[model samples]
Target chain A: MAADVDVAAAAQAEAAAPLKTPLHARHVALGARMVPFAGYDMPVQYPTGILTEHNWTREKAGLFDVSHMGQAFLIGPDHETTARALEALIPADILNLAPGKQRYSQLLNEEGGILDDLMVSRSLDEDEDGALYLVVNAACKTQDYAHIEARLPANVKLVRAEHRGLIALQGPAAEQALAAIAPEAAAMGFMSQRTIRVAGIKANVSRSGYTGEDGYEISAAASRIGEIWDTLLLDESVKPIGLGARDSLRLEAGLCLYGHDIDTTTSPVEAGLTWSIQKRRREEGGFPGAARIQRELAEGPARIRVGLLPEGRAPAREGAEIATPEGETVGTVTSGGFGPTLNAPCAMGYVARAHAAPGTRLDLIVRGRNLPATVAPMPFVPNRYKR
Target chain B: MAETRYTKDHEYIRIEGDTGIVGITDYAQGQLGDVVFVELPSIGKSVTKGGEAAVVESVKAASEVYAPVSGEVVEVNSELEGAPGTVNEDPAGKGWFVKLKLKDPAELEGLMSEGEYQNYVKTL
Candidate 1:
């Protein structure tokens, strides 16, 4: 009787918890296979499954409900002072960012390694109010906020955008879907953002995505997010995508996922993120580990990030050892997988500076077998962002 | 046609004459999602009951297929190396991983019947 009561209580608790998203009922109605992800019950795949969802994202439009990612605002007195305060904690050029523009940057530790990569967008209003909008990774949201709060000055504040729900509609037919729902969204250029009403739901829409396809990420109030998700899926081209397909799609695009391709041990220079650091920031030498980064920029870092093309059928997965022709271990594969578009195995890894060049032959040891590989260029499937 | 049996580890064995065809169950394939690669044991290699027979990798995770009965692996489905999705599409039919010449038919009694296998999957 006690065991049965415990089971009943567990079921009751699960039932009592509010199911997130406006489309939760729709997801269930469509027979989506749900899984727990980053504190939210999300669809990993629908009736079509992960493989079909992956292929659809590459060919058509795939709607991803990523409302679980953290959204917040950074407020300060002025832009310059606020940027400086932010640069002290992160490695981004928050000062030079013009209003309405967004920049992708990382929060770095004192050792110059990544804490998390986040997006910072300056608001478009006239006031020099350092009102910056940020979107951080879901898994590290709690720690990221705590770290920022502890390090920020009395004048600076980090406020969670708790009422918002973010969704990413990605792939080749994405623009069509967004245009159908909100015609004004078509004018938003790649990486550019705008505030618009998507199907009568107020949202901040940005032309950014993880699937290497033309798409937009819409952030709306939590109550209205599910409605927008359902509205978009009403279009013939749109289907729900899951985390399984998300990872494979990102891998194929040669994009880096935090906690996988990068960590606290990998510096921006070694991770092939030099372009994210602005010219003024590089010259001013004020950010964390600026001394080390400036030196590494001029003299070149010891190790560099490169894409690996594994020969034959087998995939060279994460943590696989990379070796030279002489059998000496040079580095390790950070992210690797089968590129669905390229129809071959592609990988990203760190190797000695000499081995970073494309066409450099390397050996990836997978399951005790040496898979012949070459250093290749990234984005195995070209990114079709609507620039 | 011989009666099919299942192991607790989620493998299925169908015996006919002295040969036994081994593969992962439908429930196992459903759990693995889309199988991308299948590493089969060498055709001539002998394996003991409950020993590792092959490696099956899906888009989500990797799983090892174990031998249900002691036998020498006489043949393997080389077609899986090219089309691994067969495991997910038709797990019980075309997705058979290997065929072994049984060393001991008595080992088959240790496996579960179809009814028992259904109950085992429910427990999972």
Candidate 2:
């Protein structure tokens, strides 16, 4: 009985401790500041600091360990079955998604609220047409998987690829840096995915990333991730960036961060992600919350997400109240920070439809003071994606 | 000769006559990462011991620089407005946030010396 109790206690302790990724040792060796994030002891920033890392990515290449993000595959008997199964949950028109292409979408509840935003990529190989690759945010993966599993038809299976480690190589020099190892990946267009040999290791490479800059997200076997990371860093242009710069880069790109920018309460239309939903999905009305989404598309969401440029050095961080010049509250900042590339404070927030237009004057209430801001257009820094 | 004292919060005050030049310790600047912005208190603003006198924002987050001892701010570092990186480059010298006219010299006894400060940081 005592032995069983001890074993139970040990299991409890193990579950409570934060999990370390395969690249944890490499991050430590590079003098990264480790912090708890998404149940993982992830690197927040390296000794080079966030500002330098942010600038380096804009000028050169930045490597990021995104292993904490959940990787999974939805498998069925054929492409149509699998696509239809996933379409029932998300509004993206997956059935028309060509092989080797990826589409971004969000899982929604019955009420049209976002469960989690994710990437769905169709298999590149014809023989594996039954499989669709999925990548979801780390913090929401557990619930996301459970939600997906419970709803998926018996013919389709959710295969969690927990053994894979994902990394993003991003910036102007990313292609050149990656071309040295994976020449085939360098030739792929944006949002394209394929199974390729990266540094002599078989891996899934996607010509896409959250940073708006041209980049690739490589998913390799956990055991070989360190080798891939090491080989990528050998290039003079490549530097290991942590979550800090990653957040700033995505915020500047005007991407929605799950839980912060979009949550269970925010719909894709409200978050300005309507572009991801194709015409077929919008008219057919088959997916969860399709009615509400279609209504929002025809009319407009009550509040819409927009890029906010605070008119000063002080950053209006998450939860800062967004108001009119007269102090009437219209919305709240979801993500805000100093953009190293812009050399200014940039943010994203949901404001009432009336105040969401670009160049509209607004005020952000930060620390009891009203800081002037303006509704700016997104991708604060122009996207450098190689089309 | 200037005698410097430190608080557990990592603020430092270098005393010369009745004036004290205040700034964050090198260790504090290192912990805060690259300083992107520094909000200095206005001159003539009176501060109490352990009270927040200025704000320091790094690339990741913002931190408050507390007053190590009570005094009236006689001067503020205007240079930080244009060059915040100076705090990371020379936190001990040019990064000085304010020059305070010491309200009570006895408060100095409550702070740590350089050696004590080093020992305290090691514990953290």
Candidate 3:
């Protein structure tokens, strides 16, 4: 009798249900293993399992449902005003961005810490009227929109693309797969965007991704994403992928997850993303954390993010402490896991400048055991993005 | 004929004369998802009932495998070191973790039967 009540409670929690993406029904149809993430019920992996899904994406084209990501457009009457407004919030040189060009950047706090990392792109189509398209972290979009809205000048405005769903088709075979359906997308260079039609549905496609692969991220109306997903899947080369592989793929690519590898306390220079900041921005000192960032750019950050290759099969997961051979703590692993492509455990962490060199030996304390590790260059798997 | 017993933590012990074959129940492996590494207890390591005796690392998280009854580790399934996913593939069978020389057979009485464990898992 008591057991029945317990079972009922479990069912009740499931009934409460989190938010669902536009492709939620399709995910169920595919027999995907669903889990709650970023306040949405997302598929962690399909029946093929995370290992296979990750491997498939590395070798062939993998279609992912990224609708849960927050998409918005920063609008203004002219490009100059819009770009400068964005530049004031981030450390990137948005004012100089060519139309149709996209740049990865971080939103900064007053202390020069990272608020959230995002993709900022200038409107490719002239009809957009100097509007800049932005994609922020899924969990931070609401707050990011509010933050930008409250700070922007009256000439510039923020418009949430709340009804849009995003999809990412990534990997080595992406070009061939997408060219058959959307020929114009194949013409886009890396970091370039194009507003085109996919199966007659208007979409904004970008030849940029977080997986360190040559791929495309498509933004379309939420109501049309399901049709787009079905059209893409009809082709043999494209297979549905889930968040589980998404994480491993990004980890192997050496990208930092917003809440994991970076947070409010981490600075762009310390996170090994100083390259994203232009020389003009670094010298002029205009963004939110410009002073601290400029100083870090001139004088290297005290500690920087670096990759670690643990010697054994055991993965030293997040929060694992990094110590010197003598056992003095020097750093912490922010993101670590088994890399399917490398077929070995890979990790990234922030360590003291002296200990951040590639091939520097360190010990990782994982589950009470000191495991030998070496600081290695990132993107454990070679990035195959088409130039 | 020997009978099997299960702990509330989802560990199972199959009795065979003076020895008990230990492994996590199928329900536990399902909950763990993909098994990446399994840290087996050293042979001859003594363990007390309800104390941690082994470690199971899954892609999701690591869990401690506790002793259902006091005993000395007589042997471990070394094959699991190479293929930890076996715990998810054949959990109740070839994925057994260790074999313990029972310190007191009377302790088995505290464990649940297969029927009881199924009901317990349903409640969870």
For model 1, what is the alpha-carbon lDDT of residue A189? 81
| Model 3: DockQ vs. true structure | 0.29
Docking class of 3: acceptable
Please report, in order, the local distance difference test score of every candidate based on alpha carbons: 0.82, 0.90, 0.87
Native-to-model Cα distance after best TM-score fit, residue A366 in candidate 2, in Å = 1.6
Predictions' DockQ, in order: 0.34, 0.28, 0.29
List, residue by residue over A1-387, the lDDT tens digit for candidate 2.
001011001111324788989999999999998877878888888998989999899999999999999999999999999999999999999999999999999999988999999999998899898999999988889999999999999999999999999999999999999989999977899999999999999999999998889999999999999999999999999999988898889888898888789988999999999999999999998988888989999999999999999987887777889999988999999888788889998889999999999999999997688999999999999999889
Give the per-residue Cα lDDT of candidate 2 at A382: 95
Most TM-score-accurate candidate: 2
**Tens-digit lDDT string for candidate 3 (A1-387):** 001111001111334568899999999999987877777888878877777778888888899998988999999989998998999999999989998899999999999999899999988678885799999988788889888998999989999999999999998888888887788887899999888888778899999887888999999999998888999998887899888788889989999988879999999999999899998988898898888888888889999999999997887878899999989899999888778789788889999999999999999998688999999998899899889
Ranking 1 against 3 by lDDT, winner:
3
* lDDT by residue for model 1 (B10-121), tens: 8999888999999999888886677777888888999999888888866555567999999999999999999999988888889999999999998899999999999988
List where candidate 2 sits over 4 angstroms from the true fold.
Answer: A1-15
Model 1's i-RMS, to one decimal, reads: 12.3
Check candidate 2 and list the clashing pairs: none
Q: A1-387, model 1: which lDDT tens digit per residue?
A: 001011001111233354465566767888877765655666777777777888999999999878878999888888887787788877678888877778888888877888888888876666636878889987689999998999888998889998888989999899888998799888878877777789987788888989888898899998889889889888999998877788778888888888767778888888989899988888886777777788889999899889999988677777789999789899999877666667777889999998899999999998787889999988888999888
Model 3 spans > 4 angstroms off: A1-17, B122-124
Clashing pairs in 1: A22-A226
